[model samples]
Target: MYRCDCKSNVLSVLLYVSECWKFTANIEKRLEVFQTKCLRRIMRIFWPNMISNEELRRRAGVSTISEIIATRRWQWLGHVCRMPIDSIPRVALRWTPQGKRNRGRPKETWRRTVDRDLKTRGLTLQTAPTIAADRAKWRSLAVASSTRRRRED
Candidate 1:
């Protein structure tokens, strides 16, 4: 596990988004040929033998950058869950600054993402904090949600 920095949460999310964009920039779409080539190139950096992308993915248990980011977010969420309600991390999670709405489509918030994740696991925002307090259960929920999403892809 890693320490969570509440102040750096937004920055960390941005960095994750940028890294994911960089990873997929070469591919126009997630076509199999492109995905295969990309995976092969990545694998070759660590192995010399020519191997089929399928074999490489199987051996490595392929996971997308988004999946990794989601895992990190969930871990941080668990940490926040364990904090006192008045603590900085927990306060940040619950805080809603009063501001006028922008004139265009609204920017996504971390709360929205958390809500979506919880919804996927048949959980509600009201119940999530309690569930997240149990490290093992929370970790399993995160993994199960990610695995379900992967299967849908």
Candidate 2:
């Protein structure tokens, strides 16, 4: 019951609008810390009785924050891809801003993050839409891309 409440209420609130997030390394670290803290609290774990994050997550049946965000982003991507070419979301997905900015390094954008995630699944922006056109295929791909097969260390 506690786990369910944590997932349904806490995680959902924490991850709101996460599908559009840039998901940088710092952000990922912060999210991991926050999740572990929450889990430790809910599980009534205190100092001198530490549990590894993997063990805690396994016990609680909670997926990693990155995995959850990836799943949500891909699901949303599929929805956008399935829209008509002229649809607002489709247009927005393909839109590029004009004018150069002063920059040392380019900040990560949501699109670039999605592209990176797509490459991990051996998919590309060009092919994703066609695959997403088939709902079953897209659903399977989204879930598969986010879920890592558990391995004992």
Instruction: Give the number of the best model, judged by TM-score.
Output: 2
CA lDDT of each prediction against the hidden true structure: 0.62, 0.86
Cα deviation at 30, candidate 1, in Å, is: 11
Off by more than 4 A, model 2: 104-106, 149-153
Clashes of 1: 0
lDDT of each residue in 1-153, candidate 2, tens digit only: 767978998898999999989889999899989999898889888778977999888888898888888889988999999999999988888888888756886678898998898897788888988999999998888766655433322
- The Cα error of candidate 2 at residue 98, in Å, is 1.8
Model 2 TM-score, all chains together: 0.91
Can you give the TM-score per candidate against the true fold? 0.63, 0.91
The TM-score between candidate 1 and the true structure equals 0.63
For 2-50, candidate 1 gives per-residue lDDT tens digits of 1122114322444443321222323323434444454555445345676
Best by lDDT: 2
lDDT of prediction 1: 0.62
Q: Tell me how far the alpha carbon of residue 5 in candidate 1 is from the true structure, in angstroms, after superposition.
A: 27
Error of 2 at 111 (Å): 0.4
